[model samples]
Target: MKRILVVGVTGSGKSTLARALSNRLGLTYHEMDALYFDGPGWSVNSELVDDVSRLTAGSGWIIDSLGSPEVRDLLWDRADTVIWLDYPKRVVMPRVLRRSVRRTVTREVLFGGNRETWTGWLSREHPAWWSWSQHGTRRREVAHRTRDPRFAPLDTLRFGHPRDTEAWLSSL
Candidate 1:
């Protein structure tokens, strides 16, 4: 299970699971957001592809994203295993809401040193909003990607509920 990709829609706990798996498996953990966002104001990393390519070239890694569009295909091509958190909106909405609220309330710093703000919630890009709006689309995308012939060499584990994922993690 080396070179793993933890994939899910916004607020689906991709980072948390990927980090835990990395720790358990003693693999290098790479937070995709950290790699894509470079500084304050959510500045983007212009060299994202180069950075991701370099890291994926390594023998072992667990990245907590499907990858942004620019590097998505590269990630899927290199990954030996993919863990898909395919939880429905009912499960993810509350998780995302709570997470966004807590982060906004605490002014917690995130990737690129950006913090979620009350006003940010109004934006479509906000995690809460994104999770709600893109829930179905993201699910379909993941489903299609998993079935794609180009990625047939990859082993996939798809979990439909938090409990199932938790049980599997514990078993691991």
Candidate 2:
């Protein structure tokens, strides 16, 4: 699988799976979060278009984040594979919460030099909130997009739950 794009609702383990795939396949791992969120004030990836171009210009690479809808064609047109980690809320919510708590407790530095905080976790903008609110919509959107005639040439792999991800990854 070359030129892969990993997509899912926020905190659905897209980045994690993409990273593993990159390592296993020996492809360049592009953390779109690092590109989009790597700003001075948590900006919305001001350089998204240019950065995406630069990253995808190569023949092989794995992108962990979906970036923006504005660049969907840029990615889908070039990507040979698109992996969707569409886990259910029951499985994803606790994972997101645990990840949030771990990041907050660790004071981990994320993209844009941002650190997870209790306040941020409680805020509406948090990834957890986004995951909860967008779970169903995101699943439907991904399914529809994958089924679209425009993307018919792309190979889509969807994992409905965490076990599916592990099984697939392990097999690889």
Candidate 3:
């Protein structure tokens, strides 16, 4: 549990759980979204790969997400344990939608100071859309990938219920 990769569909509480685990276990907490996005207007940062490479070069860390495939291998290759928050799609979908709307309406600044806008929320390229669209695929993809022999070095914990996850996390 020293070097962990917290994975799940958006709004499945990846960031929240990662933060808590890091604090409780005294491990470094890295939010991958901060590595990929830059200041206001939500522009994509080119240094994402470099940032992730540097951050994970250490012996221990807990990262929130690996939304990009390029960085996925980097984290997956090094992680000792993976915590998969496999919450129901219906549960996550509503949470993501509500969070997106709240952020857009309140103009909350996120990673690298970027804030979500009403226009972006309506657009097909929005994070909300990405979350919803990627939901099903990610659920299946991560499940299958963890079972492959290539991932033998890693120990994965899949949680279909939040209570089960909490119990595991608490036992440390």
Clashes of each: 0, 0, 0
The estimated TM-scores of all candidates read 0.98, 0.93, 0.92
Report every candidate's CA lDDT.
Answer: 0.94, 0.85, 0.84
Summarize candidate 1's per-residue lDDT along 19-132 as a digit string, tens digits.
899889999999999999999888999999999999999999999987899999999999999999999899899999999999999999999889999999999999999999
As for lDDT, the candidate ahead, 1 or 2, is: 1
Please name the candidate that would achieve the greatest lDDT relative to the true structure: 1
* lDDT: the better of candidates 2 and 3: 2
Ten-residue region with minimum lDDT total, candidate 3:
35-44
Give the local distance difference test score of model 2.
0.85
Segments in model 1 whose C-alpha atoms lie over 4 Å from true places: none
Candidate 3 residue 50 C-alpha distance from true site, Å: 1.9
Worst 10 residues of 2 by lDDT: 64-73
* C-alpha positional error of residue 87 in candidate 2 after TM-score superposition, expressed in Å: 0.7
Q: Which pairs, if any, clash in model 3?
A: none
Clashing pairs in 2: none
All candidates in order of TM-score, best leading: 1, 2, 3
